[model samples]
Target: MNELQNTLRRLLRVVIGGRWGVFAWSLSGASALAVILWGLKAVAIPLLMIKTASWGIWGLGVIRESKLRTPIRP
Candidate 1:
C-alpha cells in the first residue's frame, strides 16, 4: 500500500508539476473520477452527495468561525 501511494505520488508529481499543470491535473483527475463514479451509479451517487454535503457544511462552519473571530481548535 505504501509502495502504491509512493508510486502514485511520483506519477502525479510528474504529471502535475509541469506547465499549466495544476489545472490539467485537476481536470484529468476529476474526469477520471467522474467516469468511475458514473460506472458505479447507485453506490457512487449517494456517496458523492454525502461527501460533498459534508465538505460543504464543514467549509461553511470554518468560514463562520473565521467571521466570528474564533480560534481554530484541534
Candidate 2:
C-alpha cells in the first residue's frame, strides 16, 4: 500500500512538473475523451480504464497530501 501511494505521488508530480508534462497529460486526456465520445466501443472501454487510473492517481495524490498537510507543488 505504501509503495502504491508513493508511486502515485511520483506520477502526479510528473504530470504537473513542466510544459512537456502538461502537453503529455493533455494529449492523453484528449485522446481518452475523444475515444469515450466517438471512438469504437471496444477500444474506448480499454482506454476508459487507463483514463480512470490516471484521474485516480491525481485525485488520490491530492487528497493524501491534504490529509498529511504536505504541499503539492505545481
Candidate 3:
C-alpha cells in the first residue's frame, strides 16, 4: 500500500509539473488560434504559418534555456 501511494504521488507530481503547464499552455494556445483561423477561412496556409511561428518561438525558448544552462524546476 505504501509503495502504491508513493508511485501514485510521483505520477501526480509529474503530471502537475511546472514545465508541463508551460508546454500545455503553449500547445493549447496554438491549437486554439489555428482553429479560429480555420473557421475564418478554408485555406490552411495561414494556419501553417501560425504553427511554424509558434514552433519557432518554442525552439528559441529551448535554445535560450540551453544556453543559460538553467536547471528546469519541477
Question: Whose lDDT is greatest here?
Answer: 2
In model 2, pairs of residues that clash are: none
| Backbone clashes in model 3, listed as residue pairs | none
RMSD of each: 14.0, 11.3, 7.1
In every candidate, how many clashes are there?
0, 0, 0
Using lDDT as the measure, name the better of candidate 2 and candidate 3: 2
Q: Output the TM-score of candidate 2.
A: 0.37
**lDDT tens digits, residue span 1-74, model 2:** 99889878765665463343454467568767777787767576777676676566555655554545454699
lDDT of 1 by residue, 1-74 (tens): 99789767655544444333444445446645766866655456765665565445445544543444433599
Over 4 Å off, model 2? 1-42, 70-74
Tens-place lDDT per residue, model 3, 1-74, is 99789767655444433353356447758677767867746636766676677566555655554444444589
What TM-score against the true fold does each predicted structure earn?
0.36, 0.37, 0.44
lDDT of 2 at 3: 80
Off by over 4 Å in 3: 1-43, 70-74
